[model samples]
Target chain A: MVSNTNELSHEAFLYLIRQSGIDLDTGHDKELFDYVKSVLSSLDPLRSIDVGSTEPPMMFIPAQEDV
Target chain B: MTDVNLCYASVRALSELVSKKQVSPVEIIEAHLQRISETEPVLNSFITLLADEAQEAARRAEAMINRGNHLGPLHGIPVGLKDLFNTGGVKTTSGSRIFDNYVPIEDCTVASKFRAAGAILIGKLNMHQFAYGPTGENPDYGHMHNPWDPEKIAGGSSGGSGSAAASGQCTITMGSDTGGSVRIPSSFCGIVGLKPTYGLVSRNGLTPLSWCLDHPGPMVRTVEDAALTMNVISGFDPKDVASARVNIPDYTENLNKSIQGLRVGIVKEFFDAPLDAEVESIVRKAISHIESMGAEIHEVSMSMFEQSQAISGTILMCEAAAYHRELLKDHAEELYAPVRLRLESGLLITAADYLKAQQARALFNTSVNALYQTVDVLVGPSQPITAPTLLAQSVEINGTRVGTTAAVTQYSRPYNITGTPAITVPCGFSASGMPVGLQIAGKAFDESTVLQVAHAYESTTDWHLKHPDIAS
Candidate 1:
């Protein structure tokens, strides 16, 4: 639901990290936030795709009984 | 046999000597041990060297050979495993502080296969921390250096395997390729690395980077050696849920076969991206050489090729994040900076985003497979640039600044996403004397064709014969 790529403020980024159960006070918090933003930005094209009804690459198949 | 250069000898050659009783396994093992002692200080390729156990195994191999018993081509050969693989009693650190004392009670299927083939396990090779990064830089166990030039990176997560294989520390080494771990190191270290089709080799005991993407395969000095090793490792293992139920072919049997009528596809998208001039030239020349040998060369296009890195990154980040969630929660500070950041970033990827990436993966796989219907195999540069300096964060490709990680995995990662078999062979060297690799990928489960093409090119070129000056 990230509507704006540049709108991800430091405060919001830190909130997301905190919500994910990671420590926010760690020295690497900002660095981790920046990296996460970068990865999410790069995946924009894939995120925008309307993969309606298409299954994921790996799917579980149920075993059928012999006739 | 004493005068024979055991350091650069292929598994085939060494096995022949051992089978004929002309060379003792003990002597071969001792020579490698001596060479390791000399080169390991500079390369730092091994995290643990099981000298005593390897020597004892060599003694047993010698006795067996003397009694007219031979296991196979891998018999009496020294092999190294990337530390990510479980080694039973030996420590399987996975280049992380968390598992520094971790040891398994059972050998991975691949390790068991090597043992059954009578190969001596020399030690566990160092790797990128938890196979999370591609640079092979482990803060815990020093960074693995390229044998050709210590200043350059030994392309990693399987970096140590490539260094050991190239430097002749081991006759063959097993490397797990997730996002080009095997091929990147192969290209950088100037050796042959094969990333078999997903599920072709079992991943039962290897540390998981991305369960869906990880592939276990061989890294060796020559294409034939890779093929020989592949023959022993590829099979259906019931223990691995992802293991493919397919007929495993004798990969070495067709290595000498003619590739005259084969159709080789030149992926236009591969070269359209930013690439180093020398790497492009050398790879083009190698492709032309393949055409000169009577293979039909065609230009094939796939637009999705450019988006592979993104798709791969999304998938790997989410999968790896999920696997390491508990560890990150418990020991976040223990991880290397880059890996910890990467794993943390994965926690932010939404489930919808992960699924979308998988959807894109399916589309990409289908498109690439459709291209394969017209071409027997695809050929491209293994990496866009030669090995970057160990300290470099980014490299300039064709006058543009590109991140080192992106450039290193560009050509190889797409194959991993598609879950196809790809092999990197030394095609030529860069202007600075570092090695360049040419990649040949085949249809799913069609490693034989890929090996055939690589073997034909390797037999004609002298690239594989060149070794680093690390021995002295």
Candidate 2:
């Protein structure tokens, strides 16, 4: 099940990881899931900000002269 | 001078000795090698020691100087590169066992530049595995031990660079910062680390952690040594697609210039975060010290600064995951546990969230740049606390407990988000004797002013003059 909201629910996250073809060790599954969940949770505040049509920041600009 | 003194001498001091033929390159290399041997047992700073290559390079440098063919300040100086940099025919593990046998056919641009400048390659320093974690906890190799206190972390992902420079195992070292890898270690190890403006230094051959956020920089014992290193490394590289074509200036030319009437801003949000009592006191005192030097200090607010981790983390994870997609799929189990989990987390970040984070980053950059319009630089504590003990999973700040990684990278992520030049200089020491760093950040690509401000503060204080007593 794909996540409808910005935050991924535990079931949705597990589904996505399962789809990713990454096998989580049974013994460490709980530990691994919690770690990823914490990382996602930290970004929760970003969803509330109003970006106002601003373009995403440029990562790099291509040089005219080829290397 | 004794071997101990020779090992700790700054590049500027040793450059003069080399130029005047008072000290041969061979003697300098020997001193550093001897120091490395003594400190390696405790520091665990280097994964690959290049004593033979360093001596050979020193001999070549001596012969060239004998023929009156000097290469300049960096000539005959010793430098250690983080293992991420690809060196021809030499292993570049990047702090992981997976790449233990990987060797490159050609030298990375940075390594080649240093070689051309006649800097001896001392060794390849260790780091956090794949430059993922903030603490120097690498299970594949021994954890990087602090020169000040072996029980404490040296700070990562540039942990080994920090330990080596502070312990006098190398005169100068290179560190790459995605968030605060360079400055964090510089703070914990009591040294100078400078992350030049994004695109100021090329990332041509560095192992990528995050393509957009990764920045190669200098971690050294003094500000002038950083400037000297920058002179050789900073320039437009046609090969690097992200390399800026802006005119490069002599980074050392503005040193010793008066910082009178210079405006320095203190971000209110920086202090609003969780902070240690001693760290807050030391950073504020450093600000007052700058004011005493005729620099105007102002309290500024950038509300978006608090959201920096979200913005930087999102982009970093997506890019890092995209780059390492195959590696994770094919060899996930080979990675360290924490690093493996972090990389897997990146796979879960939706494209929408990644883009949303970048949009927020655009706003964050706008807010920070506006502050520079009012103030020449932003000043704050480099890390909220000093180096944490390796045995502890988290540290207590005030009455609250916070994870070590979160606390260390809090202040560092903002500068990386802005892609501006930021530097960390030792301001003072905590009650327990760990060093505190005062960060000075300037407008994008304006490293000259950043260096000027840091150099001014460094020259007026005795903080940078102190070294770890690891040898004793």
Query: Chain B TM-score for each model?
Result: 0.99, 0.99
Which sections of candidate 2 miss by over 4 Å?
A: A1-11, A59-67, B1-4
Please provide TM-scores computed only on chain A for all of the candidate models, following their numbering. 0.60, 0.62
TM-score versus the correct structure, for each prediction: 0.98, 0.97
lDDT of each: 0.90, 0.90
Q: Which residue pairs in candidate 1 have backbone atoms (N, alpha carbon, C) closer than 3 angstroms, thus clashing? A: none
Each candidate's DockQ: 0.63, 0.65
- The CAPRI category of model 2 is medium
lDDT string for model 1 (B233-319, tens) is 889999998999999888888989999989999999988898888899999999999999999999999779878988899899999
lDDT of model number 1: 0.90
Q: Write the per-residue lDDT of candidate 2 for residues B1-472, one digit (tens) a residue.
A: 4343888898988998999998999999998999988889999999999999999999999999999999999999999999999899889999999999999998889999999999999999999999998898899998998998999999999999999999999999999999999999999999999998989999998999998899999999899999999999999997787889999899998879999999999999999999999899999999999999999999999888778888998899888888888888888889988888888888888898899988998999999999988999999999999999984679999989998888899999999988899999999999899999999999998999999999999999999988888843
Q: Which ten residues in a row are the worst by lDDT in model 1 chain B?
A: B1-10
The 10-residue segment with the lowest total lDDT in model 2 chain B: B1-10
